[model samples]
Target: MDRRVYGAEPSERDPGPKPGRAYVELVGGPLDGMLLDVTGWPPQEVVDGAVLMSEHGAFGPGGRSGYEPAEAVAGAGGVGRFVWRGDVP
Candidate 1:
C-alpha cells in the first residue's frame, strides 16, 4: 500500500496503490490519543464532516467513536476515531 502524511509541513506525496485500494493509518498524539485514517478523502471533506458531526453531537462526548465519517467513504477500509486537542485553527 502507499503512504502519505498531512500536517502544517509539506504533505508527503507517494504513488498510491492500485486504482481501487486505499492505505490507512492511525496518527498518534499525546496521551495515547489518535487521529483517524483519512487516506483517500480530501482534507477539507474530513474537516467538514467532523465539524458537522461535532455540532450535532453525532458521537456523543467521544467524536466518531467507532465509524468515523472518513472511514464511511466508498474507498475507506473501515471506521476509526481520533481525539483533537488545542484550537482547530
Candidate 2:
C-alpha cells in the first residue's frame, strides 16, 4: 500500500476562490432535496440537525410553506426555487 502525505489539496494552495464549508444536501424522506447548508466544525451536526428539525415538525405538516412534506423522498435530487431557508439561484 502506498502512503500518501496529507496536507492541503493542490487547488486549495492555488488560492483561487477557496471552497467554502463542506455541506451536504438533505435528500430523501421529508427533505425533498433541500440544500441545508451546515457547518463542518461540529461534524455530525448536519444529520443531527436534520433529525431535530424532523422531530420539531420542520419537515412535517406545515413545516415548509407551499411545499408539502409528503413530497419529500430519499435521494431524489429534486430542485426548487427556495429550499428550507436558502434561496436557489
What lDDT score is found at residue 66 in candidate 1?
A: 26
Error of 2 at 83 (Å): 16
Q: Please give the lDDT score for candidate 2.
A: 0.33
What are the clashing pairs of model 1? none
Which segments of model 2 are wrong by more than 4 Å? 1-19, 47-49, 52-89
Candidate 2 global Cα RMSD: 14.3
lDDT of model 2, residue 65: 26
lDDT of 2 by residue, 1-89 (tens): 22111122435534222245333444344444444433332533332333323422334543432222233322222321222432111
lDDT of 1 at 79: 37
Q: Judged by TM-score, which candidate is best? A: 2
The candidate that wins on lDDT is 1
Q: What TM-score does prediction 1 earn?
A: 0.22
Ten residues in a row with the worst lDDT in model 2? Answer: 1-10
What lDDT does each candidate get? Answer: 0.35, 0.33
